[model samples]
Target: MRFVSKLTMALVGALALFGVGFATVTPADAASGTIHFSIVKGGFFVGAEGGNGVLEFRGRRYPLSIGGISGGLVFGASQTNFSGRVTNIRRASDVAGTYGAAGAGAAVGAGVRVITLRNEKGAILRLQGQQVGLMANLDLSGLVISMRR
Candidate 1:
């Protein structure tokens, strides 16, 4: 019994240390900036579809594509939309491939939250007027963004 307790304690300590390391390695949030764009359309899984757009932040131009799904409900009505942000202006393929995937995932996740809520409307809003924080990989390629309007 004594030996088992000591082993369990050691295991717990190791797990705590691993958790700390993992938290430290995760990417921090993106700095505040303005992202201007227009909503092209709306429907279920709506934001997944791509539309031509531009994102202006920190005096940089990020050409955006909306190719993700968005869905939600508001005032007894259902809706969906697809959209994605531009992370790399110079590397469109990378943005469309990797960064796009990451952005899509983040957008879908955020959209789901609105969907699950009973009293929220399904709308594809712009990121420019909202406050958003981005948690991305070390290379700044893949990212997870959380936002508040």
Candidate 2:
């Protein structure tokens, strides 16, 4: 029984040390608030999208400028209005960066899409938008977003 108690105490001490190391290695990311944006896009084969938006963080609204380009079978022209919530936002500048994704989607007359994307700054955006006009099989990627002055 004495030997078993000593072994248990050693195990507890090891776990405490491991917990300290884990906390030091991985710090928690601060979550800020939701962001709202609207973009208008148009092109044939190669296309561009841009518009204005606002970020509602900490009871304040900051305006943003949205811009992007899409390639691969980007047909016709369309306008999209999107709103999303951002998480793991450590700083105000974290929201401004390039978020990459290769998604093929089509919209005729009217359509809706929900997408979740993570940027290089470790911020994740859950976006849902309404698309109008027409588009087909657009493999969009390298979408860059930035703050508007």
Candidate 3:
């Protein structure tokens, strides 16, 4: 019993040391920035959206392009202009990635829209904006954003 207790204590001490080391090696906290973009979407069964935007980060602006395709119960057409904050990013380039989007919306004339999407790199875009014209959709989409040269 005495030998077992000593071995258990030794194992616990090693685990504590390992945990501390790993914690110290973790990545730094991410940064956030502002973004503005516009998208025009329309279709019958499958829909497509694309637009251009700018990212304001670290007191500089970077131009960006957005495009995506969506399927399932999509119809009509409309344009959406969004402005919001992109978080969990380390740099402006980190905002460039494939973001998975699943949403349902309907609009006639004009309406308010809000959505939160996360990319593979863990960047999250929380956007809200105005959508105009006639449109409706219930689908899954993949939106890709890239920095322009």
Candidate 4:
């Protein structure tokens, strides 16, 4: 346990020195990226969501895996096809962190959905997508995002 704690601190110190994930991100550090993700979720009053996505930034590609939980007056199941831009990227690793946002969207027939989220590292994502199926109510969701090698 002592060794693990020391290793963690050293790693964080190294990253901070190089200004990776431990600094405030400014517009100057922002890069434009696009991501396509798909999610499936279901439950009654409580729900879970999971999905995978690919991000294209500055001629490089990064794979992202996502998982999250949400609760509200939620019921039934729905799938969403999302495509959006990631912003405020201070470093490549900045995109790999938890993000939370509250949004309202429904696809009763034809619909439009948009949400904005920011993570601890100051990365922001503005996403717009289409939701299919039925699930209703307002909810706050926290998404844990990570980069897949």
The TM-scores, one per candidate, come to 0.29, 0.78, 0.82, 0.77
| Model 3 Cα lDDT, one tens digit per residue, 1-149 | 99999998898789887784433323465788999999998899899999999999989999999999999989999999999999888789989999997889899999999999988888899999999989988999889999998
Best by lDDT: 3
Name the runs in model 2 displaced over 4 angstroms. Answer: 1-29
Candidate 2, residues 45-83, lDDT tens digits: the string is 887888888888777777888888888878777788888
TM-score of 1: 0.29
Off by over 4 Å in 1: 1-30, 42-49, 70-149
Which runs of model 4 end up more than 4 angstroms from their true locations? 1-24
Counted clashes in each candidate structure: 18, 0, 0, 0
What Cα-based lDDT does every candidate model obtain? 0.32, 0.79, 0.91, 0.79
Which lDDT tens digits does candidate 1 get at residues 1-149? 99999998898789887785433322242222333333332333222223445544566566654433433321111123323333322321222232222222233212331211000111122232221222111111121122222
Q: Tell me the deviation in Å of residue 121 in model 4.
A: 0.8
Q: How accurate is candidate 1 locally (lDDT)?
A: 0.32
RMSD of each: 14.8, 6.4, 5.9, 8.0
For model 2, the local distance difference test gives 0.79
| Rank order (by lDDT, best first) | 3, 2, 4, 1
